[model samples]
Target: MSVPPAPALPVVGDGLLDRLLPSVATSLGVAGLARPGDRVLEPARRAVVVLVDGLGAELLARRGGHAPYLRGLAAAPGSRSVACGFPSTTATSMATFGTGRLAGEHGLVGYEAYDPATGRAFNELSWEDGPAPRAWQPHPTVFEAASAAGVEAVRVGPGFFDGSGLTEAALRGGRFVAASSLAQRVDATLAALRTRPRALVYLYWGDLDKVGHVHGCGSWQWGEELEAVDAELRRLAASLPPDCALHVTADHGMVDVAMDRRLDVAHEPDLAAGVAEVSGEPRSVQLHCLPGAVDDVLAAWRGRLGEDAVVVTRDEAVSAGWFGPVEDRVRPRIGEVVATMTGELAVGDSRRHRPELLALVGLHGSVTLDEVAVPWLCAPARRA
Candidate 1:
């Protein structure tokens, strides 16, 4: 079977997080926030960036009827979709968002990456027993830069994230306000904004993404959850103080994989052969091949998976700009063989991942438009 050609690589400096956060920081007058001018957002005295997990631009356009508020925002002037970088998962995108850099510079390559220092698969999200967050990702976050510039930086999210390893790694600085519910988060963000004459507030909402993962992006549950998020966002936007601007975006979009399209490497001898470890999420898998087995592993996966996935060697991936100019130190963490799912197909290792993870209906990580493109919708605060 002939494998189809890979999609065009993400527009690194222009569309990805490398430009987004720096633009935000610059707009807020944060010192040491280095980057080119933003193509999406305008300057504001107060800005609130809301990262709604799993809210893909394509998904939103297709399901706009279910979210009137978001639909209006999408249709607003200057609203456009931006590409999240390769392996467009939360862990990778969050690091990209926080550090205002690509995976190569920030070193959070994937959801789960091979940590050469520990000889284990490091889970970027949980970070349990993994390397120290500061040491693992040393880049100063946009929040930290904003705080250093004397701009009040605030993060409003769930209580558990107040001091999580992921937070420490990506969003270390700032006043962390624990808000368990959407209403609480909105309230906390508003209060934080009021605390300072100029502020940069980061708000996170994960329920829609959770629902999409469990029930599939096509399910009514996903639609219902999106509706709830839309309603809450409507309230939040309406309540923002004058001179505050609200910017909405996401880590990545999701695709619902049919059971027939799901490939279990554990069952496929060719795919499992010479693979020392399987990391990354379902849509994009990182295969750590054994010594002298790189060619064999590559051939096995390409021959077996064919057009259902794009199989590329690490060098090819780097050449293709997947991780965007990988650093020398970060190069080792990438898999020797990387496989990115295409269309509706997903590859997973049931033996390595949790049953719940493998069972997720909606998944994202690949470079497909449905997974990589997210909206950059902005609504400036209305004066009373």
Candidate 2:
């Protein structure tokens, strides 16, 4: 049996964060930044980019009743959807957004990626004893470019993220303002805007995504969280300083996966055969096979998963433009064979992943419309 072909790939190099951020920075006169073709933001003295994790365009449209503010933005004339790169997870999207580069260029391929130097699956978010963030992703970020060009860049998020690995790799060069609550984050963003004539504020809200992961995206808990986020966004928009714009976007969308649809690779002999490690999130799995075992693993996965997944070799994925011109240095970090969940099914290795991870109700990191498409809601500054 052969693996089914992948679904149509997302349009990379445009309508995504890699271009969106650079265009935002360019609008602010950031040196070395070029304007993207589809410029979404207008020239403004200050810009507030709010990243709502797991808020997919489809999810937002489906659950619009719960988020009036976001819904209105979505209904606006120029509002549109953008695609996060392949394996549309937080770490990968953030790297692309921050650096204005693809996953291949930034090298943060997924939540968990193979670090060739360490020969282990390292968590990109945690980055504990792994490679140095600067060394791992050496690209200068949009925030850094803005800061260098005399535009104030500030990041408002959790206190622990001030110097975390992901922050350093993708989001460094901004004034780190630790704000735990949504209200606090909004206040911090407003304050940062007031301090500089030209500023770029990046605010992160994760409650909805967290709730979605545990309770599923369609659950009441997720709806409640979305309401809270919508209220906060309303407040943020209403409180924006003069000549400022608030751009709301998300890292990726998610889908609810039933436990019955999840395949545990650890218990399956053929799925585990010739596999050295299983990294990446459940929805998009990376199989690092043993020497010359790539064919066996691919065949095994293709035969078992059938039409449920799109399994391809690393080279095939790169050629298909999944990672967007993968560089030589970043090649080995990718798995020998990659499997992306095309539907509601997920593949997990229980031996490697935690029970909580395997039990996650909502999952992303695939190219499905529910996972890759996110809203780009623009709320220009309005006077009181």
Candidate 3:
């Protein structure tokens, strides 16, 4: 009898966003970094990583027809689907991607992570009223590492990101080149590559994720955005130098949750009872409990959410490899009781969350396959 294939590596460590950049740095001959996924990339003098926010592997598979260029790259050799890990939101995933370290080590564990030092939750994406960004996440980014090793590192994204606290914390190494539109960003990327023989460039796009949050991931608008991205990337691919390689990836995937299936904690006394705070996103609800209230809060959330969510104690979640070796410093940021929503169900708080945010068509930040599975697609540039 033929032997079954060996079980895949756990999504927490090996096949993850934390390793993608290290692999890229490795392929570019950057020294002093261990390359866990060395073979995930091919050796190249120049590399361009295009991070399409909210582009999940499963979503791309289901909507392949709308993104032919990206779909073809996914089908190419060396292309595979990798996990974005637990709490698969942009802030967490970007910390993982930029630092080549897991959320536990990076300490930006959630979109709105609780800072034990300040005794308050802050929006990691916005970095408003948060702890000093450098003090929060002190890891040297892969960009910084690569630059130190003599590779030119550049980041091409929105102008507002140019010296933002989030940039200072996680992505501080690279020179920032702001481009407002996709076309401008693409042009900027091509120009940046031409300036140096060995360079690591990053291009960020968010319109797809914006469309998904407002119009739903499966909506025609999202499909059209995908098509537009595919067309733009196709144009980019044709202009790439032969010595370069292009890697396309994402922060997380999304799933649409109907308003009827959502629970508003402010509207439900039982759900909000003993929770000191609610910090995480709708799909992944983190409930910080009052002193001596862990068990009660866990039980209450469990009984209330039922099969709609998998409720767990903070200790239980860490043991389950959810955050991938969380450090002691990062422990309190996680809640006493955490709930990962199941199916299309979600829990939001009308009191804590804005009405517009609660009305978002698509939601993420959970361990579902749709939320964690991101594409690891790569292709070489055209011949000169």
Candidate 4:
């Protein structure tokens, strides 16, 4: 089957993250949240959100044979077969996922964005040496909202993320349970549900994303991982409380760029001219131009990269609704000039990024359908 045609998605409206949490909030009759599309998620006593990182809808559709349970969900009318908006990356998507708001509102702009306050580039995912989590992302997450409403919220993931900057910034609140394996995580999810009659449970799985990064998403390794994910989720669904609904989703999709398609600025003088720093995705580069050189830097990058990428100023991108209503504070975190790759091209910065990062087979963080489309599948309580 041909991949589904995915036009540019406006996060404010056509995003799964837009209403996911708010819908859950409404299901529990939690007020204060603007509950747009609350009907998407059926009213249930409990809800379990299983976030499979890098599990794009397009990829799943293409390789549906490997995921019988997911394929069935994709074919279901209620399932959002595709999900995502601009700058499709983990950290940015997770911000929207947790807060049920736009990237501009959440302020986790990109994979790596320039911080005007520090005059440095920081990774939004790892959040090492980055801004204070609470101060940086002031928005109250859905977990916090659920907690405030007296709903028991549980987030299950690895041990390292218990107090990580990203977790605190985007997914704070609730009891964080650490489980190393898939079975352990599933057990923890069930345990958390038992603790409360009405609860919001979140499960984060990074194995597929890691496998996709190391091996291309189209590889057999990725297919194997998908099969494993499908089985575990199926098991989890079977084991879910009869009153609880299970929702399966992801942060973003993956696209495998050829080694020859990744262009390093260090190798091209013209591409690096007038540039102060480089951040963002390899496919979508955020160029922080030197003072009084925004035009020149944009021109140089546009000229050098040619048709492989669409280069634009940050102001233009914001105006075009790329970041979805940029706030005064987040305006500077975006690059002076942003270059989002058109196809399988990536702008790599060898000087700033480690060599290991450049060697990744699968890369995302662009608006392309392959990179932007994620799946939001629901296993409703009635079905259980």
Residue 357 deviation, candidate 4, in Å? Answer: 0.4
The residue-by-residue lDDT of candidate 3 on 1-384, one tens digit each, is 122222222463237877888888888999767654345456799999999999999899999999999999998987888889778899999889999888878888888899877777888889989888888888899999988999999999999998888888888896999999999999999999999999999999999999999999999999999999999998888888999999999999999998899989998898888887888889998888888877778777777888777888877787777887898888999987778886789888898788899999999998888888899888965445
Number of clashing residue pairs, candidate 3? 0
Each candidate structure's count of clashing pairs: 0, 0, 0, 0
Deviation in Å, model 1, residue 189 alpha carbon: 0.9
Clashing pairs in 3: none
Look at candidate 4 and tell me the lDDT of residue 339.
Answer: 88
| Cα lDDT, model 2, residue 302 | 88
Q: Residue-wise lDDT of candidate 4 within 1-384, one digit each (tens)?
A: 122222244332145565677777667667787654445456888989999999988899899899998898877767774456668898898888898877888888888877888899899888978999888899898899899888899999999999898999889988899999988999999999999988999999999999999999999999999999999888998888899988888888899998988889998999888888888989889988888988788778878888777788887788777887778988888898888987779889898889999999999988777888788788777744
lDDT of 2 by residue, 247-289 (tens): 8999999999999999999899999999998888889999999
lDDT of 4 at 204: 95
Candidate 1 versus truth, CA RMSD in Å, comes to 2.3
Question: How many backbone overlaps does candidate 2 show?
Answer: 0
* Model 4: colliding residue pairs: none
Stretches of candidate 1 exceeding 4 Å from the true structure: 1-7, 10-14, 381-384
Comparison by TM-score, 1 against 4, better one: 1
Q: Write the per-residue lDDT of candidate 1 for residues 1-384, one digit (tens) a residue.
A: 333344467552237756676777777777566544556355678989999999999999999999999999999886678888888999889988888888877888888988898768978888877788898889888888888888899999998888788899887898899988898888888899999988999999999899999999999999998888899999999888878888899999999998888889889888889998887878999988899988899889888888888898887888778898898888989998889988678888888788998888999999888899998888865554
Candidate 2 lDDT for residue 265: 92
Considering every candidate listed, which one attains the maximal lDDT? Answer: 2
Scored by lDDT, model 1 comes in at: 0.85
